[model samples]
Target: MKRASLLPAGIPIGIASLAAFATAMIGGTITDLGPWYDSLIKPDFTPPRPVFPIAWTTIFALCAIAGVSAWRAAKDSRTSDTVIGLFALNGFLNILWSLMFFRMQRPDWAFWELCVLWCSIAVLIVYCGRLSRLAGLLLLPYIGWVTVAGALNWEIVRLNAPFG
Candidate 1:
């Protein structure tokens, strides 16, 4: 009986998990902490290289859970679609920032783009939280992580400027 009851939850969880996986894979592939990155003068506060994968993996997992909560709590298809759309937008912005900062070697541009990414995460927290408390609470860590990333990015920009 419990197994049958959980089927509805299984669907959304599976979908959200897949979406999270895709986002992480795509973003991780494009983010290159290569020679250019090594050449930059990072702050002493900068997280060690290993910290990034662990942090991002944990964040994506939580986001998947949050996405499931929001999807299930939504009252209408439109509401569910909206939540999914916002996540998609956030995912795109997330990947783009990596591409800009690491792959393109443009932390300056990445810094500006990070503002929009932060906004997307903020909107996700408010909008998803309205739909489901668990969803909103789950996203709290995401915002915090992004805040730390933003500070790191700001410091990188300050330390390394005039990039072509």
Candidate 2:
């Protein structure tokens, strides 16, 4: 394997993962965001606050790993096609969720946005599975987290809807 090939294989995953990590930390940094979050009446299924960062970090890492693997597979095959497209789609949805929820402070809009994100994630998972089984597996945690986040978003919207 040429060194250049390895670079191509690894770069997308590494770059995307780092971007995800930064976003997660930045999202965590909005100091009083917690109070805003806490004030909302969440569903009983909502996990504790601390769990989110930890879970996101792990999921992002997995996504990066999967990206690298898929990239390597694609590079070897001389094309990225579906694998790369799916990864890009998933990333777009991920960032959109943050922008909708935190920046816009629109949980109602965020709730609907998450549905789009969830669907994109599902498509990514199935598409990644076609390219690499490990890549598909890497998305499982992300899908799970999004599912929970979706429910939380719904509850937040429901609770805040009347007033906001």
Candidate 3:
């Protein structure tokens, strides 16, 4: 068995890498943790700020790898399309959460959007898992991070209400 056969109909790994990294870049750009964010009341469990970039970098890298694996593992074009679409949607939702919470300074609205973002991740697990178990398993950390994010968002909303 040769590895070449696996990628016969697959997309270039760079495309997957670009898609994944682009999401991170966009989201990072939208996030502004300046004085406004500093004034907010965060939960006692808030990890050191450094934890964020490290985790996101690792997650996006995993997502890129998983994207390629899922693409190549797809046995049919339909499966391939579905896999790509799911990843794309997840990226959009990921960015949207950043825009809502940090840029808009509305953790309240962001919390609602995060719920939708969470659902997208769950869907990715199902679809990506069916295409490639490795791809699906790789997303577990993403969901975990989002769960932590959800808790943070909820706490932010609770601690700082009456946003203008």
Best by TM-score: 1
The C-alpha stretches of model 3 lying farther than 4 A from their native spots are: 1-11
Candidate 1, residue 52: the lDDT equals 88
Q: Model-by-model lDDT, in order?
A: 0.89, 0.74, 0.88
Clashing pairs in 2: none
How does each model score on TM-score? Answer: 0.93, 0.80, 0.92
Instruction: Give the least accurate 10-residue stretch of model 2, judged by summed lDDT.
Output: 1-10
Task: Report the candidate with higher lDDT, 1 versus 2.
Answer: 1
Q: Which residue ranges in model 2 land beyond 4 Å of their true spot?
A: 1-13, 26-34, 75-82
Distance (Å) between predicted and true CA of 44, model 3? 0.7
Q: lDDT by residue for model 2 over 1-164, one digit each (tens)?
A: 53336465457666767866765665555424666656767778878878877898888888878776665666444346556577767677777778777767788887888999899988878767777789889889899889988888888787677534
Could you give me the TM-score of model 3 versus the true structure?
A: 0.92
TM-score of 2: 0.80
